[model samples]
Target: MLAEGPLEEAVEGLDVEIEWKPFELRAEPKATLRPEDPYLPEIWKRAVYPMARRLGVDITLPTVSPQPYTRLAFEGWQFAVEHGLGDAYNHRMFRAFFQESLDLGRLDVLVGLAEEIGLDGPAYRKALEDGTYYERHQDALRDAEAHRVQAVPTILVGDTRLEGVPSTAQLRKAVLDERARLAASVTVEGVVCRADGTGCA
Candidate 1:
């Protein structure tokens, strides 16, 4: 939530394509944290809510205890992407979890969210039920591991990587810097020389 606003402003009218990837905070067999847990509330109070308030994004600590594992939800994401509704699916998922307190770990809930975004509900449900996208989702997880993603909202612009929620100015600067680097490389390669090769030096 905190990253969304700043990210939107930073990439506005820029030739940037945002790709949302899977990063499960509590991947299976690992237990999901409960709001009753001191760690959950402590971090939310200290960091999340303050950042949300500053960014003017509406987000809350979900009350779902023993929160659901996200493997199934990410599988649904693969389905959504195949149908060209990937971005919408991601936005709805975030709203469902953080805002509506909906359980994403449930197949029925996932189908409902998919249907809400005009995806074929039955097809999505069948895909999840039969584990059709399971391997695909696993492949995505492996990609994330290869990237060594240690935090959420990790933005990579050229060689500049911003972990956690970055300010709009910081994100904008990284993007501009990357663009400048690409432009410089292009300029060097595009230099013209005389046919005689006298100006090649």
Candidate 2:
């Protein structure tokens, strides 16, 4: 997705929406903590952040919450990735929790971030606690599994699947191709209308 700027631009006028999908963060088997292991948060900052900005999408990683129906983990990831917030926010949260050793799963931290970004912190926090988006998250996870996405940063460009970090040229080509196909199928027309159901130019 990050690699296809040209393609996206080529089809900019067409009414189309790109959907991003994120992978689940399964807990690794317990092992002795290695100080030398690269921090997950830093890795994301260095790798995923820049590309995500270029792609103009967000990524979301849903952690287990105490809420009820608001557990839309997978869907949240998709939404985050689509909105380009996944890397920026998630990386920050992950760093706070894993590297800096802060509790990222806490409501206060999440709410703080929401506030910082001018999102509805209280509402979003409540949703997390209440599991308001749980179904969507679960559904997204199922979709990811069905698509065999076993890693982070998977790019789904139409029928083409590119996994891991892709080059700029590759991404650009994909975007262009996607736009071309969409443009080929749809045509725009102009129409004038009056409130009284009478049409005029």
- Residues 137-197 of candidate 1 have per-residue lDDT tens digits of 8898888788888788787887898899999999999999888766544223667454444
| Count of clashes, each model | 0, 37
lDDT leader? 1
Candidate-wise lDDT, in order:
0.87, 0.54
TM per candidate: 0.90, 0.53
Name the runs in model 1 displaced over 4 angstroms.
187-201
Which digits, one per residue and each the tens of the lDDT, describe model 2 over residues 1-201? 333453456446656565644455452232323223456346557776666766664533222232112123333333444445664555554444434444344567666755554456566666767776666776776888888887756777787787776665676677778766654553226654444445545
Model 1 pairs in collision = none
